[model samples]
Target chain A: MEFEYPIEGGDFTRAGMASSQVKKVLKQLNIAPAIIKRIAVAMYEAEVNVVAHAFKGTMLVNIMPDKVFIKFIDEGPGIHDIDLAMQEGFSTATESVRQMGFGAGMGLPNIKKNVDELQISSVVNKGTTVELTTYIS
Target chain B: MKLTEVVNKLELEVICGEDLLENTVTGGYCSDLLSDVMGNAQEGQVWLTIQVHNNIIAVASLKELSAILLVKGLKPGKETIETAIQQGIPILRTNETAFEIAGRLYNLIRQS
Candidate 1:
C-alpha cells in the first residue's frame, strides 16, 4: 500500500496527521506492533521536521510485505550543515515551535534511530530529501 | 489505576470516548514533546500534555496509551478530536495544570 501527504510548512498543529494515518493503516494490515511503532516514530519525526523547518513538503509512504519506505521532500532553505542538523540537540525552531514542546533537535536523530536505512541529501539554496526505510522481517 | 478514578480526582471532562473511562492505566507520562513521548511512554500509560495538536493523538495511539489528558484547560480543535475519536483513543480535557494533574494522578495511581 502507498500513501502521500502534503505537509504544510509553519503549520505546527497539523504535523503528525500523515504518521497517524500510516499507523492506522499498518495496524489494519496486521503488521507487528513493534515494527508499527518504529515506523510511526520515524515518520512522525520527519513529518514534524517538514512543518518546523521547510517551507512546504510532501511525505510519501510505501509499504510492502517485507519493508516500509518513507520519503520526505521539502522546498525550503535546505540544511546548511547536515551533520550538525543530525545532532540530537541542534534545532533552529522558533520560540513558538519551542513552546509547543518540539524543536529539541531530536527530530532527525530519532528518525535515524528508528529506521533501518536513512538517506538525506540537500542543497543550501534549494531543498532537501530524506529517505527512510524499515524492514518488516 | 482506572481512568474513571483519574477523571474523578482530577476533575476532568471527558471530551470524547467516555466509554473508555473504565479502562485501566498503568502509568502516567507528562510531556509536550512528541519525540520524547514516542521514545519514553510505555503501553497502557496515560499521557498528560498541554499540547492539543493532532500529532499528540497520533503519538498516544502509537504508544497504545489508555487515554490522553489535555492539561491546563486546553481544548483540542475539531480536527484533533475527530482524529482521536477515529483512533478510538479517549481524550479528556482538564482545568488543572500539567504538573498538578501529573502529581495528582501519581498519587492516585500509587495508592491504588
Candidate 2:
C-alpha cells in the first residue's frame, strides 16, 4: 500500500501527522513491533525536517510485506553540504524551530540510524529529496 | 504503578483515552526535546513534556510508551488529541511543571 501526505511549512503545529498515520497503519498490519518503532521514528524526523526547512512538501510512504519505503520531497532551500547536515550535531534551523524542541541536528542522523538504506539528494536552490527504506523482517 | 494514581497525584486532566487510566506504568522520562526523548525513552515509560504536537504522539508510539503527560497545563491542539485517540495512546494534562511531575513520578516509581 502507498500513502501520501502534503506537508505545510511553518506549520510546526501540524507536523508529524503523516508519520503518526503511517505508524497506526503499520501497527494494524501486525508488523513486527521493533520494525514499526524504527519506521515511526525515522518518518517522524523526516516529517519535522520538511516542516522546518522546506517551503512545502509531500511525504510518500510505500508499505510492502517485506519492507517500507519513505520519500520526503520538498520545494525549499536545499542543503549546501550533505555531509555536514548528516553529522550528528549540525543544523541550520532558526531559533524558533529550536524553541519547539526540534532542529537539534539529530533529525537526519536518527533517520539514517533507523532505516536500512537512506539516500539524500539536493540542489542548492532547487529542493531536496530523501529516500529511506526499512526492512520488515 | 497504575496510571490513575499518577493522574491523581499530579492533578492531571484526562484529555484523551480515559479508559486507559487502568494501564500500568513501569517508569517515566521527562524531556521537551524530541530527539532526546526518541533516543532515551523505553517501552512502557510515561513521557512528561511541555510539547503539544503530533510528533509527540509519534515518538510515544515509536517507543511503545504507556502514556504522555503534558505538563504546565499545556493542552495540545485538536489535531494532536485526535491523533492520540486514534493511536490508543492516553494523554494527561497537568498544571504541574515538568520538573515537579518528573520528581513525583520518579519517587513514586522508586517507592513501588
Candidate 3:
C-alpha cells in the first residue's frame, strides 16, 4: 500500500500528523508494536525536520510485505553539509525552533538510529529529500 | 501502579486527561529534549519534562507513553491541552523541578 501526506513548514501544530497517520495504518495492518515504534520515531523525526526547516514537504509512504519505505521531499534551503547535520550536536535551527524543545541536532540522528536504511540528498539552495526504510517482516 | 496513584502521591495537577488517569504506569523517563524522548523512552513509561509545547503530546502518543509530567510548575498552552485531550495523552503538572519530580517518581515506582 502507498500513501502520501503533505507537511507545512513552520506549522508546529500539524507537525506529526503524517507520522501519526502512518502509525494508524501500521496498527490496522497488525504490524508488530516493536516495528511500529521504530518506524514511528523515524517518521516523526522526519516530519519535524520538514516542519521546522523546509517551506513545505510531502511524505510518500510505501508499505510492502517485507519492509516499509518512506520518502520525504521538501522545498527549502537545503542542508549545506549533510554530514554535519547528521552529527549529534550540529543544528541549523533558528531560535524559535530550539525553543520548541527540538533543534538539538539530534533529529536526523534519531531517524538514522530507528530505521534500517536512511538516505539523504540535498541541494544547498533548492531542496532536500530523505528516504528511509524499515524491514517489518 | 496507576497514573492516578502517581498524581495523588506527587500532588500533581491533572492539566488534562482526567479519564486517562487510570492508565497503568510501566516505567518512567525524564527528558526535555524531543529527540531523546522519541529515541529512548519506552512504551508505558511516564515522561517527565518541562516542555509545554504541543509536540510533547505527539511524542507521548507516538511512544505509547502512559503519561506526561510537566515539572517546575510549567503548563502547556491552551492548544497543547486540547491536543493532549484529543490524543488521549494525560498531562500532569507540578511545581517541583524535573530533578525533584524524577527523583520522587523513581522512588515511588521502585518502592512499588
In order, candidate lDDTs are 0.87, 0.87, 0.93
Model 2, stretches more than 4 Å misplaced?
B53-55, B73-88
DockQ of 1: 0.61
Better of 2 and 3 by TM-score: 3
Q: Is candidate 2 or candidate 3 better by lDDT?
A: 3
lDDT of 3 at A108: 96
lDDT of 2 by residue, B49-101 (tens): 98897768877876778999999989898888997998789999878788888
lDDT of candidate 2 at residue A115, scale 0 to 100: 93
Q: Residue by residue across A18-127, what tens digits does model 2's lDDT show?
A: 88788889989999888888887788888889899999999999998888999999999999999999999899999988988898889999988889999999998789
Candidate 3 per-residue C-alpha lDDT over B17-82 given as tens digits, one digit per residue, 9 for 90 to 100: 999998999889998889889999999999999889888999999999999998889878999999
TM-score of 2: 0.87
Judged by DockQ, which candidate is best?
Answer: 3
Identify the superior model by lDDT, candidate 1 or candidate 2: 2
DockQ rank order: 3, 1, 2
In lDDT terms, which candidate is top? 3
Query: Residue B111 CA error for candidate 3 (Å)?
Result: 0.5
Error of 2 at A13 (Å): 2.7
lDDT of 3 by residue, A83-122 (tens): 9899998999999888878998889999999999999999
lDDT of 1 by residue, A11-114 (tens): 86577877887888999999999888888888888888889888999999899889999999999989999999999889988988887788888888888889
